[model samples]
Structure formats: C-alpha cells, structure tokens
Target: MEIAQNYLDSIRFEFERYKTMGDATFAQLDDSDILWRYNDLDNSISQIVKHLSGNMLSRWTNFLTEDGEKPWRHRDTEFEDPFTTKAAMIAAWEKGWQCLFEALSLVNPDNFDTVIKIRNEDHTLVAAFNRQLAHYAGHVGQIVLMGKMIKGEKWVSLSIPKGQSEAFNTKKFNK
Candidate 1:
C-alpha cells in the first residue's frame, strides 16, 4: 500500500515537472513564435499543444470509468491551430493539465491495481501513467527545442545553462 501511494506521489511530481518545463519554454516565446514550424510537414508549438490538450481531455476525463480515447476526439483535427495568440495556447495548456492533475488526484492505493482502457486496450494504472508521461515529455522537449531555436542566443535555459554543470554540481555537493 505504501509503495502504491509513493508511486502515485512520484507520478504526480513527474507530470508537474513536465508541465513546468513546457510553461518555462512558453514564457520565453512570443505570440508568433508559438506558431512557427520548420516546414509544412512539421507541427508548430501551437499544433503540438492542441494535440496534447485534446489527448489529455480524452484520456483523463472519467479515466478509469471510460475509454481513454473518447469517440468524440478527432485526433487528426488536433493538428489544426485554433489559437491566434500565446494566451489562447496557454489557456488550452492549463485546462488540459488541470484535467490530468484532477484525475491523478483521484487515484489512491485502493484503485491503483485496477486496469484502465485506452482505445479498448487494457492497461495497468502504471502503464497508463508511463504512457502519458512519455508522450507529454516528448512534446515538452519539442517545445523547449523550438523555443530555443526561435530565440537563438537569447533563449534562457530551463535546466542548467551550457557550461555551468560544474558550478551546479559544486553547489549541489556543498549543500
């Protein structure tokens, strides 16, 4: 039981970390920056965000009780950008994370052993968590990388800045 509780706690932390990383990346970009893509085939930050939000809404709503992939979700359509500005993109991002965190908060030791379904496929709760974590983390990486590219030398590092690892580790060791 303690292990289940700990796992839930850690998973929540991981989700929040990913969300924070994306938020930090967004903070450095302008409105037009969010919509920039390398090519027509590449997805812009807005497109990635829309897809993430749609996936979160479908997968987290009534999560354990219903299929994670809701019938109403048009996965392809998520690539379409409805956001014209950074604020709109941020709103969607926050709403999606809200749904995810709310659903996660409901998971406890009692239900941790149950299986959840996504697209009619069975998944242990741990598997579901790992799945979403990987998906979101990948998108967050894209957001950060693109934001860096858009900002060039002006981009601020979310983690340790380049060439500062020695200083970072020294501070850590001293602590």
Candidate 2:
C-alpha cells in the first residue's frame, strides 16, 4: 500500500507541476494567442487542452476495470475548435487533471500487480502508470514549447532564467 500511495503521490506531483507550467504559459498570452495554431494543420493550445482532458477522463475513470480508451470518447473530435474562450479551456484542463489525480489516489500497492486492459492489451498496474506518465509528459512538453513560441521574448522561464544557470547549479551543488 505504501508503494501505491507513493506512486500516486508522484503522479499527483508531476501533474501539478505540468498544470502550473500550463497556467503560467497561458497567463502570458491573450485569447487570440491561446487560439493561434501553427497553420491550418496544427492544433492550438485550446485543442491540445481538450485532447488532454478527454484522455485523462477516459483513461483515469474506471481505470482498472475498463479499457483506457473509453467507448464514449471521440478522440478525433478533440482536435477540432470547440473551446470558445480561455476560461472554458482552463476549466477543461483542470477538470481532466482532477479526474486523473482522484483516480490515482484510489490505487494501492495491492493493485500494483493487477492487470489492466488498454485497447484490448493487458498491462500491469505499474506499466499502465508508466505509459500514461510518458504520454502526459510528452504533451506537457509540447504545451510548454508552444507557449514559449507564442510568447517569444515575453515568455517567462518556468525552470531557470538565461545566464542564471551558474547560480542555479551552484545552489544545487551546495544543497
């Protein structure tokens, strides 16, 4: 149980970090900037948020009992322009992460070896957790990168500022 609890805690921490990064990024942009896509073929931040939300809800809900891909999930539709406002997009993003954290909290070490199905394939609980973590992290990186591109020089660094690396490293080394 301790293992499961720890795993859940780590997942929560990771999700929270990503959420914070996303919030900071969004705060740097206006509605128009948030909605801007690379071109006609790329997705905007709004679209990515929608997709992440959909994935989180479907995969986290009944995670152990059902497939990661829910029957009601329209995966392709998530890419379309549905979010009309920044508030809506933020709400959807928070909702998805909330679902994921809640579901993860319910897991225990006892279930670590439990087999879960995703897309008809069975995976151990740990494997499933790792898979989702990788998936979410990939998207979070994209979100941060896009946010930086949209904000340009106005973008605030989430981790470290330029020319401050030596200071940051010194602090870390001292610690």
Query: What TM-score does each of the candidates earn?
Result: 0.97, 0.90
What value of lDDT does candidate 1 attain over all alpha carbons? 0.94
lDDT of every predicted structure (CA atoms): 0.94, 0.85
Give lDDT: candidate 1, residue 16.
96
Give the CA lDDT, 0 to 100, for residue 86 in model 2.
87
Q: Which stretches of candidate 2 lie over 4 Å from their true place?
A: 1-5, 171-175
Clashing pairs in 2: none
Return the top candidate by lDDT.
Answer: 1
Give lDDT tens digits, candidate 1, residues 18-117.
9999999999988999999999899999999999999999999999899999999999999975577999999999999999999998999999999999
- Name model 1 segments beyond 4 Å from true: none
lDDT of 2 at 25: 82
CA RMSD of all predictions = 0.9, 1.9
